[model samples]
Target chain A: MIKAENLYFRYTEGEAETPFALNGVNLEIKEGEFVVIIGHNGSGKSTLSKLMNGIHTPTEGRIVIDGIDTSNEDQIWEIRKRAGMVFQNPDNQLVATIVEEDVAFGPENLGLPSEEIRHRVDEALDTVHMSAYKRKAPHHLSGGQKQRVAIAGILAMKPKCIIFDEPTAMLDPSGRKEVVQTIEHLNKNEKITVIHITHYMDEAIHADRVLVMDRGKIVMEGTPKQVFSKVDELRALGLDVPQVTLVSHKLKTMGYAVSDENLTVDELVAELCRLS
Target chain B: MSIIIKALTHIYDKGTPNETVALDHIDLEIASGEFVGLIGHTGSGKSTLIQQMNGLLKPTAGDIIVNNLEITKGLELPKKQRKKYAAERKKQLIEVRKKVGLVFQYPEYQLFEETVEKDIAFGPQNLGLVESHVKQRVMDAMALVGMDYETYKDKSPFELSGGQKRRVAIAGVLAMKPDVLILDEPTAGLDPQGRDEILGQLKTLHDQEQLTVIIVSHSMEDMAKIANRLIVMNQGKVVLDGTPKDVFKEIETLEAIGLAVPQISYLIRALNEKGFALPDDIITVQGAIDAIQNVLEKRAK
Candidate 1:
């Protein structure tokens, strides 16, 4: 469980006054729920993710991870261990030359026994479907594989919630699909609460709830169907809905009784055939 | 100028245990004044192939001829005449670099100048152009990328926004007056608005300058809208070379290589499979809308 109340953050780099990077944000996440946050670049999605895992302290308001308040200095480590972070660049998070060793780094730093660290490392690799590449050097792995290794490293810490900030931004389409699938599996099977931040609208279509942030505020929040149906609102926010949603919207404008909430090609096809 | 590749192959760390084939017997011919898009799965030799197109990476075995000049072949000449051949090859490469401007992905990270004008002028000044000519080229390059000379010329490149910094980086390449422009993932990490603006600018620049434009990107939608021709690479080979319409039709092949056709292509194909008689090669949004509208109108009649 994660909770934020009236959270505000400002990066004071310019003059005496710089606009808040995150202005008055409020959020709550239940255990094992998959929540996706979508926004344009510089909309504070990343800042929010950092705030969740104690990487960035809020300038105002409060954040509580599980049972510990983030503002409490002593509880920062506990909060971070409870909620791990997977950043955009996989290379930055991985510190080991080998894949299995990288996964072991987190638990080892937590002062776990060497045997326990080895066991956790194996389980984490298996969880991310990266067990086969345990001994391989990271430099030889693909981008998607490298990202999975990063996630496995976080998993070895045994965190309840994982915050991924644009983890698929640098990946190709297949790589994006691989990482998204891994995230979904972690949420569904492992019961890890997922706070995924991404710019890809299609990735958000399957989320339990989608939150849209703009100019440091939550502009919209709902189920994928409920959120994507508001085409004009999302477009006004400089956000893109799925292609199927766009096509269905066009068909609706042509007086066809088609739903504009379609998020996949198969959904649109089935809807069109149903109308016919 | 045209670029012709004859049996080009590149091996990294050759003769060592870590030896790996980066490019394998590849042949590609890019003509002057054509807008082309290169799409490939990661490690499919897109970067290696582009590096070879310029003189950055010499082919391990093969030749690259630039406008009737043998750029890569002469490098493999006999050692007896090594001194004379090496001089000629170096000269040719220097000349080739000026004609082929390659912009790597996230080029803004390479920007280091205190002022934007100084960064853009770096490429032209390297060519030994006179002061007046170099200044004119800097202004021309800035205009090509839609950066105002007066406002940005003196501004620190580090202080600019993400899109502006990227534009200035591209302008640095353009200042060299390259006839052929190759950009690797120019729109990576940009916001949607910024991505569209940069792509629109590239299209306009390609039109006004009549330069050979080759863009390597992973976004099928953006490439579909801008590129007239598309090259699909997989496993160090060009799997398909054709127009966007033709390339997108090989959906199964693209997917097999871990790439996808543009999103609208799937939508149009779905409609066609659902018996709407929609065209199959639809890659752009406007084209798909027009096709769907025509189908709906026909059904009404």
Candidate 2:
């Protein structure tokens, strides 16, 4: 649902010496695909997400969301509506006091009818399993709950795609699990394209595709197993593989018959079990 | 410095409709030179307990003694006598504050001085140290956090990278030379490399300087690797306190309370449940590897 060609971005104005935040990134994300982007800080993953959401247009080349070009001024709103963005901080994204009202804010901006907004809000909350918290204040909820409410807000807008920029960085383990599961459900069940950018390697395990970014370039791209099996390369890029992936890789290096593609604990354990 | 707590209870918005107990009648003792990892879900009283240790929050009831000084003793005095002893209490708290350093989350935002040296020197300068002593403290602090004194000292704190800026902010705290250091989520928001660098430096400081260190984190993997002792809090109370192996053994309890052991623990448990004779106390990847190797070799025999 999103396409980019030779994407280049630089924050500096008229400065040739300053490096580009994003440089020569070419990408194509299919509709309903769950794609995860992993990188170290300053790796331009966030920059690519912004370009996809039309928050910041490319300085060189272009990005197209669905059928609309992000750089096209007239279709900027159209691009945004098609690709909703959820940020890292849940408190900053939430606007209204009450949960349901917060979910309705986006649809209200879209100028939907009151009844339609109510219907969409309820449906969105149900999708995220947050209908029970509709009447509660947003501040009273946990980090995971607040993030799900934020996701519900985006869903109420009925976007075809959503770009989450480190959505679980501020959350605890359970909170991280909740947000990751919600994102997975949105992609598998709801048929929405997901572009999740995060530093957490474990969250990328269930993704359909994983893109590794480094110094403003797409350095690697493949399935989670295909990408994570190169444990040393990922570590050289300042990224980490899953703990199980690392353990399996180490065992392979020691002349064991473990699969290099093991991404989960169960997979690794089952492989090690066979060695006995 | 050692921290001793007895019946510590902290209630936010007390006596009001929105009153909530942030910390229950909790009791904890952290001895000097011990590296403690505090883990809990958000709003689980980990922060409340640490703040009380540093004298940032006065307990609604109970007493906190730091380095043999009863910092929370004055709070229990009657209102009239409390007023009379307010000056004495303030002086005692000031002493405790100098001995215990508490670093908040995202501490880089706390750096506001013009240069890195000035920022690190801020705390010592505030303590009325002379210029020479402040300079020595700044140099010592920079060395402790593994920052070069001559290279980045004159540069503005804003010009550094996220990791460097964080180290500089931590250097600011280290300049005070506290006997105990408490950091809440020290590695949050940092990349994999940056996170490892900070944690490695903290381990070095704990071993080399013998500084009593307490770190609050949500990552069970990190705690399992670095902490000598793990303290788990839940619902404003200490639910489990032991070594990482001991605490992670109660995986059911941790999962029920919205916490988790390291992934390696789960792997070992799964392997054992599948009829393998692996040890369940493993929490780190290396520990798992060694244990699994032993089991596999024995099976091969």
Candidate 3:
């Protein structure tokens, strides 16, 4: 569970004279939900994710993760332990070269017992379906495998929520699919709340909820269908609707009696069939 | 302008312990003015193959004939004869490089000039153009890529937006006025608008300039939209080479090679399997819509 009350954040000096990165943002994410945040560069989406994970303290308002106020420095480590963060580049976040050692790094830093750390590493790797690569070097694996290993490292901490900040931005399409599918599995099977920040509209299609941000605020928030239906608005904000949505929109504009509500190919086909 | 390869094999570090075969004994021909989409997973030797076409990398064995010039054979000649052949080859290479421009992945990393004008002029200037001719080519390239030359010419390339920066990087390659432009993942890190803008500019260039375009990407939707032919590579071998419709029809083989069909094609295949009258070769969204219209008309009849 995550709650934000008028979250205002600014990456600036002492006074509020400078501009805020996130301005007057209010959001609530339920436990065991998969929420995708999308926006163009500098739309405060990445800043929102950082605030959710306690990476940055809010400037003007409050953020509470599972009843733990992020403002309290004493509870920062505990909050971070509960909400793990995975960055864009897996190579940057991985602390050790060996896969198993890298997975154990998080638990070791958490000051868990040695036996508990070993157990956590094994369980985490197994959860990510990376147990077979435990003995290999992180550099030797594919981009998707490396990212999965990074997720396993985070899962070793046994976090309740995971915030992925453009996790697949550096990966190829296959690698992107691997990371997306792996996150979907984790959210479904483990019931771990997922906050995925991405620029890709396709990657956000299956999320339980979608949040579109722009100019330091949450401009739109709804289910994928609800949010994606505002194709013109998203395009005006420099974001893109899915290709199928664009085609359907074009057809509708040409007076083809096509449904604007269609997001996927199957829906588009069914709608076209009905029209005919 | 066509390129022909005969039994081309490239082995990295021959006779060494870490020797690996990057390219097999392959034979292929690329006709002039063909828009080919090269799709492969990373490390599938696609990059290696492209580099060899431009003489950026010499093959360990076999030969490459570009526009009837035997490039690989000239490397094996004796010193004096090689010097004469090298001089002739240099002329041929310059002509080839002028006709074939390569924009590597992360081409923005190659931008290192103080001003956009000078940066874009680098390619044409290297082609031994006069100052005025180079300036004209720079402006032409800038306009071709949808950049306002008047506004961007004096500014630092570092200050432009990401899309503009990518365009400037592309204009640098375009200034050479290449007949064949090879781009590797040109839309890799761009946002949707940026990606569309770049793709649109490339498409316009392909149409107006009649430039032969080779785009190496893994996005099936992108290939489906623009490419006339798709060349699928898996583990240093050409697994499939055909039109987008033809290549996507073999969904099972594509999946087996760790490549995904475009979402529209996948849906069409699924519908066809579920006893719908949809066509199997629907690769694009528009194509799928057309197929569905035909099926619906058939159902109505």
Q: Write the per-residue lDDT of candidate 2 for residues A160-188, one digit (tens) a residue.
A: 99999999999999999999999999999
> Each model's fnat?
0.52, 0.76, 0.38
Better of 1 and 2 by DockQ: 2
Docking class of 2: medium
Off by over 4 Å in 2: A15-17
Q: Rank the candidates by TM-score, best first.
A: 2, 1, 3
DockQ for each model:
0.61, 0.78, 0.41
lDDT of 1 at B97: 89
Ranking by lDDT: 2, 1, 3
Residues A1-276, candidate 3, lDDT per residue (tens digit)?
Answer: 899999999887676466788999999999999999998877898889899878899998999998999999999989999999998876788779799999999899889999999999999999989999999989878888999999999999999999999998778778888999999998999999999998788988899999998889999999998898888999999898887787677777766777776678788767765665
Candidate 3 chain B worst ten-residue window by lDDT: B73-82
Q: Which is the leading candidate under lDDT?
A: 2
RMSD per candidate (Å) reads: 1.7, 1.3, 3.4
Off by over 4 Å in 1: A13-17, B130-132
User: How do all the candidates rank in terms of DockQ, highest first?
Assistant: 2, 1, 3
Query: Which lDDT tens digits does candidate 1 get at residues A1-276?
Result: 999999999877557767899999999999999999988878989889888988888999988899888888888888888999998886777899999999998899999989999999999999989999999999889999999999999999999999999999889999999999999999999999999998788889779999999999999999999999999998888778877788788788878888888888898888767765
Model 2 residue B228 distance off true place after TM-score fit, in angstroms: 0.6
* Tens digits of per-residue lDDT for model 1, B54-129: 8898788898988777887566667676567777788888888888999998899999988999999988888889
